[model samples]
Target: GSKVVITSVPRVMVEGFLKEYLSVGHVIGTELHTFGCYFTGFLTSSGLVVRHRALDDYFGDRKPDIGIGTSSLYDHLFISSCKVSLNLGPMF
Candidate 1:
């Protein structure tokens, strides 16, 4: 089996930034889907710890599906003027 690992700055920073953004409803246009798994976590100024495991008995032998897509207008002047930097590191 292949494994995927996603690492970022200290958990605290990620949680803080995400929490603040979520509170302000800044996360728009993304669909939230529900999965039959129990996810528990605790958050503090520095970070969060979460644990989630899918139940094997509930859905057996089926591969989990995941996908991501983004939409942007290339013709927009603002889009043409925008700049983004991609950092190949734990923090970006």
Candidate 2:
């Protein structure tokens, strides 16, 4: 079985929605710290910016068979590190 992991900087709360909507198995998004159920608007200690960290979280020491993303440099970095990569053009 292949696990679909979505990696991006979408709002913390929207991660789950996107995961479900996209029917992906997991999500790696920028997590925001909250206070008393209210967003503090600050990123948590482990923000998913650097691609390797997100990859470590999901893939550990192993790389995925394929990596897909937009044309941004960040995405390029992530996809390049994979065994195979596909660029879907710019997201914005």
**Count of residue pairs whose backbone atoms collide, per candidate:** 3, 0
* Per-candidate local distance difference test: 0.27, 0.73
Please give, for residues 2-75, the per-residue lDDT of candidate 2 as tens digits. 56564556446666776677666666677788899888878788764566567866787788888888898878
In candidate 2, residue 29 scores what lDDT? 70
Q: TM-scores, in order shown?
A: 0.20, 0.71
Residue pairs with backbone overlap in model 1: 11-47, 12-46, 12-47
lDDT of 1 by residue, 1-92 (tens): 22211122233234445546534222111122324562233333334211011212222454323212123221222112223322233321
Cα deviation at 49, candidate 1, in Å, is 10
Model 2, residue pairs in steric clash: none
| Deviation in Å, model 2, residue 30 alpha carbon | 1.2
Q: Residue 61 of candidate 2: its Cα lDDT? A: 76
Q: After superposition, how far is residue 55 of candidate 2 from its true place, in Å?
A: 0.6
